[model samples]
Target: MPDATFKIFRGDRDGGELYEYKVPIAPGMVVLDALHYIQAHDAPDLAVRWNCKAGKCGSCSAEVNGRPRLTCKTRLDALPLDQPITVQPMKSFPVLKDLVTDVSWNYRVNKKIPPFTPRPNVEWKMDQREVDRVQEFRKCIECFLCQNVCHVLRDHEKQEQFGGPRFFVRIAGLEMHPLDGLSRTELLKEELGIGLCNITKCCTEVCPEDIHITDNAIIPLKERVVDDFYDPVRWFLRKLSGKKH
Candidate 1:
């Protein structure tokens, strides 16, 4: 019924600025709807990305009032409308234009991890509990909000080093699979740089799927890396035996 002001970021990778707009609010309106209104009424050049506005596609992710969220799922009334609703592209990725970012780096990191390969000559059968464990990680919609919130990726700019939480969840799904034979500990340690995580749980908090990126995925993977590389007794034994596996 009343007009709400929005400070939406506009620009390319080289430069940008938050531009203000006024849109009349409607009952049960979401932030995405407001942005669409702005596009129709004010700035036709406004760039934002969305597909399934029902929140299943995860394509509408953006920082609303500086918090990573799916704009389609974020309710306008939930925010303080008296203040300008600040919407910006995810800080973790380079901006392509407006709220759409270049997320191709996430794909490239994903390709580095090995695909799921079942153990040779083993039964394909698995317990329901095991299936349930990996199933949690599988719920991810690739919103990349977890990745965007990760300080290792967002603050430290470890794109060349860390795989971020999304891939860690993927690696966790593979590593925890009952039939999966291949070991990604080496890959996790060397390339993905799981050690750099520091168990902040920032990734876990932002995940739209409610996947436990820290407790279920990252901590266990960290433990495996520590055992494989950092255990002093094991290292000593390996040196004594002069064996490399």
Candidate 2:
């Protein structure tokens, strides 16, 4: 019934500022709907990345009211309409344009993880219960909101050293799969820098898929890293035998 104000970020990698716009709110209107209105009525040149628009593709991610969210799923009525609704590109990555970010870093990090290699001569079939735990990780749509919220990537800027939560979830799926033959513990420790994560659980809070990034993926991976490198008994055995247990 009333026009809601939107403070949308506009600019490129060098820098940018929020530009305010007013759009007519409709019943059950989502933030993406408002953005489409702006693009059609106000700023035809505005850039936004989206696909599916059903929250399944995870492409319409942005910071709404300073929180990482999928704009397509964020309802206009849920926000405080009295003031300008702030929407900006994710801060963890470089901005390509208004409301669009350079998420290519995530791709680069993903390439380093070893792909799932099933055990040789293993039966193709397994009980559903065996895969039930790993299936939880498959729900991830690669939104990277988890990555944007991770302190290791957001505040500390540890991109070179850390794989972020998204990759860890992927690694968890691969590591826990019943037939998977590869071990990623060393990769998690040496390359991904799993130890850098202090288990803040900020990533889990923003996840739209409800994937337990901290508890299920990250913590388990962290435990494997500890067991391999930090266990005092194991370290002593390795030192005495000069062989890994």
Candidate 3:
């Protein structure tokens, strides 16, 4: 019924530029559909990474109008159809090709996090209610949109030191568990770089899964780090107990 122009970024590891393609628009269509149309008719070589069109897949992450969002979930109706929709590859990682970014950095960061370690119990069980608390975070499909939107990684390029928002959510989910045995407070502060997050809550806004990354994950880790190392009363109590800081 209508037509729209997509201003898409295209290129490889060396560099890239925005390329525009006008395509017919249909009702209830998403950005991913538009990209597919371009690839089908106009730009056969346009490279984009995606697995499932449904929201559950978390495969279609990109910057739509400079905001991190899953392309499959972003409908055309919500955007200003009069203007060319700008779709760019995520800024946090190396761009492999048009709209496809090398998300391997996230895998490296994930490795730095301690694997889920449950306390040694011949019989391992806990309150289902306790398990329910971390379930929302487990819903993360590893889209890394939250990581892309984070200012630390987006603007500052802190990829070397900071593990990004997704990992913070990972750490928060595991640390909050009632049965998990790994205390990562020291590691959180020192190695994983939880201290870099300023609690801007930007990550929570872009989550398609609706996970409370800032309040539930980062803040709790911040509090844990403070209590473990910086709390004066806790420090004095530990000193009285002849514990090392």
Candidate No. with top lDDT: 2
List runs of model 3 lying over 4 Å from the truth.
Answer: 243-245
Q: What's model 3's overall lDDT?
A: 0.89
Off by over 4 Å in 2: 236-245
Model 1 spans > 4 angstroms off: 235-245
lDDT of 2 at 17: 96
Give a tens-digit lDDT track for model 1, residues 1-245: 79999999999999999999998989899999999998898889889999999878989999999899999999998999999999999999999999999999999999999999999998979999999999998898999999899998899999999999899999999999999988899999999999898898988888877888899999988888877799998878889989642
Q: Write the per-residue lDDT of candidate 3 for residues 1-245, one digit (tens) a residue.
A: 78998899988879988888898989899999999999999989998888989998888899999899999999998999899999999888789888889898899988888888887882576789988989978989899999999999989998888888899888888898887888888878887788888999999999999999898888888999999888999999988999764
Give the lDDT ranking, best first: 2, 1, 3
lDDT per residue for candidate 2 within 42-153, as digits (tens), equals 9999999999899999999999999999999999999999999999999999999999999999999999999999999988997899789999999999889999999899
Cα-based lDDT at residue 88, candidate 1: 98
| Clash list (residue pairs), candidate 3 | none
Error of 2 at 100 (Å): 0.7
* Error of model 3, residue 242, in angstroms: 4.0
How much lDDT does candidate 2 score? 0.94
Candidate 2, RMSD to the unseen true structure: 1.4
